[model samples]
Every structure is written in C-alpha cells, then in structure tokens.
Target: MDHVQHLIDLLRDDLTAGRYRVDLVDGLWGDAAAAALFRGQTEPAVRALDAGRASGTPSTPVESFARLFLLGQALPIGEVAAAFPRLRVAGAEELGLVVPAGGDAGRMRAALDLRPYSFVDTLGAGSWWVVSDLGEAVLGRALDKDHVLGIGGASTTLSGLMIPTPVDSVLDLGTGCGIQAMHASRHARRVVATDISQRALDIARLNARLNGIESIEFRHGSLFEPVAGERFDRIVSNPPFVITPRVDGVPLYEYRDGGLVGDALVERVVREAADHLTPGGIAQLLGNWEYRAAPPGSEEGGSDGLERVRSWVESGGAELDAWVVERERQDAPSYAETWIRDGGTRPGTPEFAALYGAWLDDFDARGVREVGFGYVLLRRPAEGARATASAAPTPAMARYERVAEAVGSNPAGLGAHLEACLAGHDWQAHRDDDALLASTLVYASDVTEERHYWPGHDDPVVMTLRQGGGFARTAPLDTALAAFVGACDGDLSVRALCAALAEVLGVDESLLVADLLPAVRALVSDAFLLPAG
Candidate 1:
C-alpha cells in the first residue's frame, strides 16, 4: 500500500517537474506498459544503485532506499508496462512516445502531452488529492486499496432517471465511493450508504465531506445488513454485478465485485428490493444479468441477450410499476476482458490470463452465455392491487421514445419532458381558430393517436390525427372536434369554443356536452400539446 501511494506521489511529482505533460487526447495508460516505462526513469535510486555497483562506489542512503520504492510500484501488468511508451522521455529517447500505427507527428505530440487524456486527468489536481486522501485512509492501512471509485457515466445515468420525489429516507446499497448516496442526500431527508468494503466506506465518507454534503450515514456492511429493519421511501444501488470466480486469497476490486455467485447478486438485490421500500416508494438501480444462448429455428425460443433489471416497488398483488432498459450486452470473453482491463490488469500477462480464465470458468460453471447491463426504475403506488404471484413477472407500463436530439446539455429540458410525460394528456385546441401560424401556442401529443369517443355506446369512436398522416390517409373528426382543431388556430378556450360549436350544431347540445367534455380535459393533462395558458 505504501509503495502504491509512493508511486502515485512520484507520478504527481513528475507532472510538477515537467517530467511529463498530461495529454487529454490520450487516456490513462494500462498497468503493464506504465510499470515498464517508469521502471527506470521514475526510480532514480535504482539507477544510482546500478551506477554505484558498477563503479565500485558506495551510494547514498537516499539511493539505497529507492529499490524498495521501485519494487513497490512493480505491478505484474503488461498494460502498465505498455503505458511507459507514452511517458515523457527526458534524455536520449529511442521510442520517445508511442503513437498508433500510421499516426502522424501530431499523434506523437498528443501522446507526449498527457494532460487532457484520461478521465483522471479531467479531475486534475483533484485526482491527486482524492488519491492521496483515499490512500491515507484505505491503502495506508492493511485494508483494500485496489477499489477506487466515484461517479462516472453509470452513476449519472441512474441518478438522472430515478424518480425524484422527496422522500423521508433513502438507502444506497453497495455504495462504493458513495456517488449515489450523494445524489440521494439532496432529496432524501435521511440517507444511508452501505458497502461491504471498509476501505470504500472511508473513501465514501471523505467524498461526502469533499462535496460539502452532510447528514449521510456511511456504514460498512454488505447489502441490507447496515439498516436491517429500516424501510426507505427510496432505495438505489449500483452494485458490483460482475460475476467472477470466488478465488481464495485474491483481492476483491471492491467497486464491481459483490462476491455473489453468477446472477445471484442481482437477483437477490431485485427480489428483496420490495422488502426495503416503503409503500408508495421507489427504487432505481443499475445492474448486470446473464442471458443464455438459444438454438436456431426451434420456435426461436432462446434467452434474449438482455441485462434486465426491475425496481420491485412494494405493493400488494399489483405491487409495482417497473421500467427497464437493456443498455448493452457482451459475450463471456468480452465481458471478462472488459472487467479485467477496468481492474487495471495488463493484457497478455500470466496473471491477466489466469484472471481471464477464472472469469470464463465462473461463467461456464454457471451456464451464463452472455451478460447484459441496464437500468431499472420501480415505483410502488400508494393505491395498487395485490395480484397473486405468478410464474413470471408481467410486462411493465412503459413507453419508449428516441428523444436524443431533444435532450439538450441543460438538465431542465430533460426534467420538463419527464414532468409532462407524467401528466399523460395533450393540449386542447379551441373551436374557432383555423390558422396555426397566427397563435403563439405549441402542442405535444400524449399518445400517437388522439381518440374522440362518442357517448352512450362505445361502438363508434372517432380518431383525430393531430399532425403528420400524409397521402390521403385522413382520420375522422366530429364537427365540434373539427371546430376545436381549427380554433386551435391560436385562440379561444375549449369551453368558449365548445359553446359556440354547440350553438352551430344545435342537434342536442347536452349530448355532445356530456360526451366530449372529459375527452377535451384529458388532452391538457396528457400534455399531448401545451398552450400558452
């Protein structure tokens, strides 16, 4: 641990001394190459030792002690060694900086400038600070230092889609570096973050302070152990769902390994989520699941390669409204390699190959054909059915839209869209308007189709098209609705225009009045469209 800390400190010192420039274009080098490259230059003491031994001259104690330091930093990783090619070469340089094949001088220069390169570089001096502080608490002791983490893409994705209603209590299961707990603290009056790793708990606490967040309780326990009987209005987790073999004496990566067998971690987490949620509460999580491969043409019945996750909101019979998105999928070897690199393992090394084999063996033993990763959002409404448990879970009440273009850099745009979606209604068009260009009104659709149901018998329901049904494919609209759509030309209330339409139609005013009024109201609430009002 001290060796690792010393190595990080040396790297920081090198940056300060102009020994290397942080390049944004190039990301963090892997462990193997980094180790080999830094092997000589970063260890001046080792260099002085060899020089002194060859010259038969005694070296200074400062030089004598550098060997231990170098030994500490020697990670048995090929990637770290490979990373050395990217290091800023000082004197006589052979392979000065490694550039991709066919890369130009610009690529070489970019590799030399390590500033803007990796995610850690974006953190700047903050990264050094975080590493140092974390090192003091976790690595400095005989505890796990391999696990270093913070909010990245996965954290923010889960945070954004989580139902954000204020809640009395929140729990962040498998808190790791506590990014989720930090977000939960903003809305949850009480927030508790739990992790099996004590080192992770220390860093999580440090992060809470660094971000100026208070009132969060950080506990060292696996899963629900920290708060056994306490139910939360909201619970969220970005658990370690990576399925790895239970190797004896092997250090855990703390960030991604939950130590559960195969899909057990994810399954147990989801299955028990309802137990921890308060009535009318919600739980959102990000996890990985296994999907088995199926044979072809035999009814096409194989496991869909999907990483499925659900919120498991506590409700009676019809207990929850769950939403899941299958974000990405990977086969056994790909998944194994992805995680190994993520854990700082060097590719092609003995240890790396061994770890890779173990991961695959674990997968094969469990019959996991593919791994899926995705998000889950579950809500337990205050009033919902307690349907009988079935063999399989029912499909969720969900809608999908490709709104990537609409999601601006600003969060407000995304938040507003969600709010409007919850209302489930479109806007109402007045009856007297005809020219849409005349008004400042804008409209959105609650659903793709707008239904104009006739009262009394449910047999003949007229459907009106709001926009964009080209080529002689016209939808039916009653006179009153046509007037409402035309009046949407920019002015007039639904009531005011409906009254005028009633007078004009004059068949039986009460009939249209009773039938169409509720439908008109449904539009506004649904946010199918929004008027200036």
Candidate 2:
C-alpha cells in the first residue's frame, strides 16, 4: 500500500507537470495520425512519434509519456527516467508499470496500459490517468480471461447517458475501470462501485486514487450481491452483457461476456435492479436482446426483442416505469461476425471460422433471428404512486419505442434531456382531457415546422413538426393541429386556441377540441410543447 501510494503521487505530479492530455497528444501527431489511432491502427502514430525523435529536437515529457504508454512503445530507460525525474525508472518498476527490455538494461516497456482520458460533463471538463490490463493491440494476441478493460466507446456511451441530477447515493454495478463510478461521484454525495473480478476492482481502486476522488466505495461481488438489502438513489451499469455461447473452447472475456446464454445476464440485471433502487430512483443501462422468430403454430412469429425487455420489467414484483429505446438491430449472422471479430479473431482465419460456427449453432438452438441493442431506463414509483391490485389501472408512464434515428445537436446534454422528458411524462399523466384543455403551453425552442407543397400551391400538402434536439423526433401534422401548434405561445389557453381554429376552419368548436386533444397531450409529453404559466 505504501509503494502504491508513492507511485500514485509520482504519477499525478508527472502527468500534471508534463501536461499529458488528449488535445496536446493529438496536436503532436496531427489529425491523420490521431484518426489512425482511433481506428486501432497504431503505425501512423508510431511513425509520427519516431519522426519527432529522429529530428534531433528535444522531446517534451508529454510526447515521451504518450509514446511509452499510449502508443505502447518502448523507450530508453534514460528517457523514461528524465520524463519521471520524481518517480524515476526504479520507482516505476516497483509499481509494476514497466519492465526491463530483453538483453537491454537501458530500455523499458510498459506492463500495463496507462493513458489519459478526458471528458466534459455537467461539472465541466476534466482528465484522468487510467490504468488497465494491456489490450490485444498491445499484447499482440488474445487477451487473458481475467483481463480488465480501460475506457472504450461503450463506457463513454453509458457515462454520457447517466443523468446528472443530484442524488444522495449511487451504485455503479459491474464497474470495470471505475469510469461510471467516477462520473457518478461528480453529482452523488456517495458512490458504491462493485465488480465480480478482483483485478477489475484493484484497477478501479487505483484509478479512483489516481484521480484524487475518494468518495467512491469499492466492493467485490457480481451484480447486486454486494448491495443486497440496500437501495440507491441512482444505479448505473455497463455490464458484461455480451451474449456468448456456452460451449467448449470459446473464450469467455471477463470484460464483455458474463458466461450467460443468450442475453439472460441482461434480463437478470433488469429483474433484480428493482430491489436495489429507492422509490423514484432510476436505473440506466445498455443491453442487447435476442429477437427470436415466433415458434411454430404461434399467432405471431418469434418474440419481439423489445417486448422481452418489457416482460422483464413487469416481472420485477414492482410497478416500475420503463422507457426502452432500441437503437440498432443486426441479424444473427451479422451479430455473430461483429462479436467474433471483437474478440481479437480476424476474419478468413480457421479460428474465426470455428468461433463463428459456434455462434450460429447457439443461435439456431434458440430460434433467434435478430439481435437488438439499446438503452434502458427504469424508475421505481414514489410512495403511494404505484397502482393498486384491486383495479386494472393503466401505468402512468411507459414508453417502449425504436428510436434508431440520430439525435440532433445536443448542447444541453442527452442525460438532462431524458430526465426532463420523464418529468414531462409524469406531468401529463395525471391530467385528464378537461385539465389538458384548461392548460396553456409554449413550444420548445428546439422545435421547428417544415412544410412541403405542390409546385405553385400556397398551402403545404405535408406538414411536419421536427425537433432540433432530443431524439430528433418528427411528427406529421394535420392542418388544424399545425395551426394550433403554431399559435402555442403560452398566451392563449388550449381551449381558446381550439375555439379560434374551429371558427377559422368553419367547423364546430366542440368537435375540433375533441380532435386535437390527444395530439396536444402527446406533444406536451414529448417536449415539443411545454406547460406554461
């Protein structure tokens, strides 16, 4: 522990003094090299680093650190020593971050992946030095079963989706390198991060200390075992939800595969999360579901993937509000190919072929035709908010849809937008038609209307209300609805607007009010229209 603390202090000082960061490293290599690095091709970045060295120009500590760690290249012991001056090569060896190169006492190579990760959140921008097990690119072979992963695309996605609303406590289940937990610590008063792998916990602990963040409590267990009988105000997980076949000789990656058959791990997480959340608490996660073809003699062919997720929520023993979005879908073969390639198996190779076959056989046994990947948000109702068993009452809020479209320019952040959308849903839920008609609304600034008309016609044949941000939703509008939306400046009540539109269109006011009420409610729920004073 003493040695680890010393190493952490040295690393913090080195990174701070050297100014090792994303922008500086990118500027050092130029755009093309940075793009190549992003695509997992390190040759361009290596060449650029070598060029800087060969020019006989003195290298900055930032450049030396990037080459030795970020690029996974060896450097002379003397150069590393100069970059670290404080920790020195001896201290680095003690930290197990580097080892002497073969037959050369003057050179050293990294034993782990240490890189600078930067991001912007509700708190503003910050960077941290994250350490994890070396990846396939650095190892030049398949990863060990217990390998821990550093920040990746999935990590960023889940982090970005995390709602930034202040909370008392948060649970980061399946915390890998502690990325999610660290993000949660920014808003929550306390955070608990758990992982099934001890190695992951070790690295995550190292990361928390390295960043000077101490509010996160690390626990060792799978899923919710560590937090049994406890509840949190918010829960975030990017679990090992990869659907891997349970067969011989198929390597199960600790970072991705949870050793479950066909998306069961994700289902289990969904079902169990209810017990660990406070009333009105939110659980956000990313998952993949199998869309099986309907069984023989069934009214519908295989089960719908999104509906399966809905069933999981319903079986949770709690009346949970669910908002599920299926962002992308892939057929069986394509899904198999993608995951197989992800495991460091190259296509057109014997090993790849065998693993691909295993995936297909597994899918065939399950009758799976396609796989859908998406984000899920589940919220437990507040006290007395749940429906009673005596009545077959409708859920106040439940949305399950396929929003595969791109989100527009989201300057305010997606997490904030989603939180607001949920609040909007709840606000509209308790209002009946009469109450809705009595309300006034203002159009969201991000929303605009588009019209297409015949060549010379003044009136548009088609009218669409499009949101510039927040899911980039667009709703087709009819003549009366379009006019009503245009007049929603919060100055006129919904009832007044309907009355005026009816008079202008030469129609009965009562009928017009009835026709536009449902659409008005939908608009309000979706944030296209907002409640006004």
Q: TM-scores across all candidates?
A: 0.53, 0.95
Q: What would the per-residue lDDT of candidate 1 be over residues 371-419, giving only the tens digit for each residue?
A: 8777665665544322213322233344321121122233421223333
Clashes of 2: 3
Local error of candidate 1 at residue 286 (angstroms) = 0.8
Worst 10 residues of 2 by lDDT: 385-394
Candidate maximizing lDDT: 2
Residue 507 of candidate 1: its Cα lDDT? 53
Clashes of each: 55, 3
Candidate no. 1 TM-score: 0.53
Which is the leading candidate under TM-score?
Answer: 2
